[model samples]
Target: MMKSLLNAANFQLLWFACILGGDNWAVAAIVLYLIVHHYFFVESVSEWWVILLFVVLGVFIDGALIFDGWLVMPPSIWTFPIPPPWLLGLWAGVGSLFFHCLSWGLTRPWLLSIGAAVFAPLSYFLGADLAEVSLGRSSIATWALMAFIWFWLMQVGVFTTRLTIRRNGRTHHV
Candidate 1:
């Protein structure tokens, strides 16, 4: 229990560091940590795969947002319209949370939606404050759209885990 809690905290801290600071090296370190930690501690490779899936999905989503001009990243760092390294790192940390910190929300869609509605926009708003990213058109409208996007992402995570369980032919907590 303690270890899980600590891992969860670590994930959040890594996300904050990457997003708020735009630290690429921090993201690299986090990737290393996830690799080593998963090798020894995570129960199965499937969980790691799920994490990868989350990363890919997250990156794609961010790419779409950037492409549509809903979020504006630094032009210098906007290589290929995908989210920058720091945001990709944030996705990795968020991927981990689907199994650990925020796992409880998987079974509670309404709660997850409510949480996402509040916290997702808050994170972006915080990011804006840090000058990492900016709302593309209107701040209020962008935030509302971001809330909906995150809510969908959370729902997809739960659904994906369920699909993984069925395909694996075993019941397991993701």
Candidate 2:
């Protein structure tokens, strides 16, 4: 049982989950800042609530994309034959990590949005390629496109989040 638990695929899945959760945690830092600083104040919404919502949304999006064939995992990783749950977990983990990383930024919303749009895709592709090599999958150009799509999605998420905060009459902190 221990051997099976320590299998390579399982380890990969674990790492992926960590990344997903970590990114989301990072994002939560930003939300916390907004709440404490009163930059994006919403009467009905609390920081924890927004964080939870973002976590759920990120998980759902990741799972849906993987299940729909928009993204492919490494071939050697058969531990997650059922893609949805694995992806959902991974998304949550990675998003948390990202949020943590960007928590202390002083940039404006538009700048942050643009930066995320550009970097997210590049980072996704890098991660994908690393996964592919580790999984021994054939190289494909579609992965590049997948990275671009990821970037676009990240941009949309940031844009929508910012807009929502602004609509609630919150001031931009940076």
Name the top TM-score candidate.
1
Off by over 4 Å in 2: 1-45, 75-90, 93-107, 133-174
Return the TM-score for candidate 1, rounded to 2 decimals.
0.84
The sequence of per-residue lDDT tens digits that candidate 1 reaches over residues 1-174 is 565676677876776667656754655767765875586446656677777887898788888888898877865444565677777777776766665656677679679878888898888788766755767878779878888888888887777766766777866553
**Number of clashing residue pairs in every model?**
0, 23
Tens-digit per-residue lDDT, 88-168, candidate 2: 444433333222233223234455556655665555556655445232223345445545556555555455445545667
lDDT, residue 72, model 2: 63
lDDT of 2 at 16: 52
Worst 10 residues of 1 by lDDT: 74-83
Worst 10 residues of 2 by lDDT: 97-106
